[model samples]
Target: MSLKSERRGIHVDQSELLCKKGCGYYGNSAWQGYCSKCWREEYQKARQKQIQEDWELAERLQREEEAAAYGSTAQAPPGAQPLTFSKFEEKKTNEKSRKVTTVKKFFGASRPGAKKVLGGKRRGDAPEAKSGSPSISRQVSLETDRVSKDFVEFLKPFQKPGQDLYKQCKIFLEHMHHKRELSIEEQSEYAQDFYQSVAEKLQTRWKVSPEKVEKAMDQVEKYVMTRLYKYVFCPETTEDEKKDLAVQRRIRALHWVTPQMLCVPVNEEIPEVSDVVVKAITDIIEMDSKRVPREKLCCVTSCSKHIFTAIRTSKEEPASADDFLPTLIYIVLKGNPPRLQSNLQYITRFCNPSRLMSGEDGYYFTNLCCAVAFIEKLDAQSLNLSQEEFDRYMSGQSGPSSSTSSSSLLPRGRESSCPEGSALALVRHNLEAVGQLSRRQERVEREARRLERDLIEWTEGLGREVRGLVQRCPLRLHPGTPASGTPAAPAVAIDSDNLEDPRLPPPLQPQVYAG
Candidate 1:
């Protein structure tokens, strides 16, 4: 055949002119020269079918593996939609970025600075720093049982069995105090609002019921009333205020007394504390008066004395020294002393040893004995100097009877106010002779003189400290304004003293209690 005819004609025997697989199909005369129409169709169909089957089998295996791992074939909800930018879109974005990176790598391979210019990570995938606030997981941990233990420990002293409601009550009171300065009437209104808020907080934050919150608040109020009755000066309500006309009473009693405004409670007798505790407390007062702020020192000293008196005369013994010690220290460290002085003075009538001793079944006798012993001990300790030195000290000091500005703050009036004919005055005179050692008739006079000197000198020193403290931290009732540098006590108007019953008998002798 001619060469041109041979190129165009089919050659059956020549494999090069036929399909490469020799499938009895004519070759296409293309680059691979593999197969012709019919045979190429069958071959393509078989390969495509295999590929399709492989893809199906892989998908089936993936589903089975997922079901095995999760123990269920979880599916999206009926109306659930896919995310706007899903993994499929992300995959396309990643592939396109890779292609761009590959092309850039080839083009920039010769340039040393190109690597430095390129981003280390894809911009969209870069990590961001977390915010400064604590995570939700951490926030949730505060309300857990782990934190309850700490709350319980704090409120243990104030808690009743199976409940620590007083902690919540304290929160309410403290919030009111800290919510900016409010006037007396304003404070009352704010306190009522805060009280309600505390109830809600207990119900929500503490998981307490509304009923429990109300009950706890009531208990807290009663406890507060009891405390105000004994310690708070210028309390919101009192027997004296109650006796006034309703309109006047509301106006006067609108004031809110804070925990810091401790006073000897009205119409309440001083409760007795232990002699040991009283002695220790007094020692602290004497030693730290200068180191502690004048206001705190005075308030704590006053509180300690009041507690001592209360423990000495109260029919019931204090729960424990521990119960009062922490609280006492806190008051000493933080109490407002100026307000405390007013409180002490207001209850002077109830604090008379003579009255307590004569009152039916009162423990005033035991109280007086303890107090006398304490005073004697203190007096003996004070007389450590030579007789001449003691005499010199005595000569320079004024007696408690003197009402000089320096000695005015002392609680001396309570003793001196006893009538001349009263047994209380006689007892005082005898107690004044306690430290004497009588030798002969003349020696007795000398001993009495020494005892008197010692008593006067020691008391004078104490009065001086009190006066200094008051000067440094002036009480609210002081007439003149405090010095520019001095810390001023919180101010409240002093109500006029309620007159005592005219027929009431004079306090019996403190000496009678000693007997």
Candidate 2:
């Protein structure tokens, strides 16, 4: 045959072609086994299928493991994890441990010219450092169960980082939230909101004075500077931390306004709370307050002695300190600049006590106490006064009181127009009386002074008995040595004097349940 025809006609052996003993091939039955290439292809496909199946199985197993592990613990049982974030932490003990802690590891940070983590975090993902503000943000705290915005801000310096740093941070913080030392360059960490809030809580509840409230704020500041900064802690904590504990103290500083403005609601249990709390909510429902013109009303020297007094508080024992927010947000949302009374009221309530104010606060004639007193005195004089007197001295009709220019924005007052010589003379007289009494009382021991209050109480009792006995007879209490009491004992009576009573008697409701 020709060479090409011979090559084409050449045939291979069947056993050689099949190659069954060493390899596995599905269709090649000659060897009764398989070929190496066929076996490799089948093995690869089966391995891939098995891998996919294993992946599904592992995912299912992981879910089950999480369920079993978390069923009995509050460590967020799988699906319930995110729900925990939305729930209120009634008690701090119930909070879960965070997954990662801050540590003082030297990331390429301290190379001398190190900037704050200002550029390493992505803007979309991480919290931005608060810049562009040369003035400090105010801080205020409401209660034990709350965190003021100030506290959150205080945590900022420790948190601010650039995008790249933040992503690395989230990873570095992985599964080990224990404790971390942050490197803040001793910037201002004073929680302005927290301080203001604390002052408000104290003012409305205990009717503490602004100066005393400031003292409390100072106490709280010391606690934060010394204690909170000293160690790493859970984000949520009890009222026991020095800062927290000090702030939690119940005494409230208040405005020299009406009790309704500050002391109106006693506790949540008091049904009046719903009435008071419901007013704001219902006002939104009931009457739509219109945004009236920004009338140029003459400036008034209205103010509050403390933040809480400025807020219209509910009577609930644990007063809802957030009362100021809803009303404020409402006014802002409505695009209506609130009236001076409303504006000053909310502003005084919201402002951090330590941030903007100093010294004795001025009172509006509308101050419930002053109004009541004015009314009683008016009634005592006659059945009624002319509308001019009512508008000039009673209610909130007057532009401002003589004592007002001494408070808030303006400090200059024309020292004239007191019944005796000038308003300053009157103020000086009252202040002098109070100052001498204060000095004399402060000279005694606390316990002895307390006994003196009891003595005053006894005298009050004796006087009451005498008055009752002589109600029908022409008898009276002789003005002899005035009964003395502890510095704090008269606080309640002093508060009682501030109520806005429509009748002739001084309103007797105690401002503070206990000093």
Best by lDDT: 1
Judged by whole-model lDDT over C-alpha atoms, candidate 1 comes out at 0.37
Residue range 141-260, candidate 2, lDDT tens digits: 122113333444333443432222223323423312222222221111123334544566657755667776555454344334222321222111111133222222211111112221
Indicate which candidate wins on TM-score: 1
lDDT of each: 0.37, 0.33
Provide the lDDT at 152 for model 2.
41
What candidate 1 gets wrong by more than 4 Å, as runs, is 1-149, 152-188, 196-515
What is the per-residue lDDT of model 1 for residues 20-72, given as tens digits with 9 covering 90 to 100? 56655433322133332333355456556666765665566555455543443
Q: Root-mean-square deviation of each candidate, in angstroms? A: 44.0, 37.7
What's model 1's lDDT at 364? 19
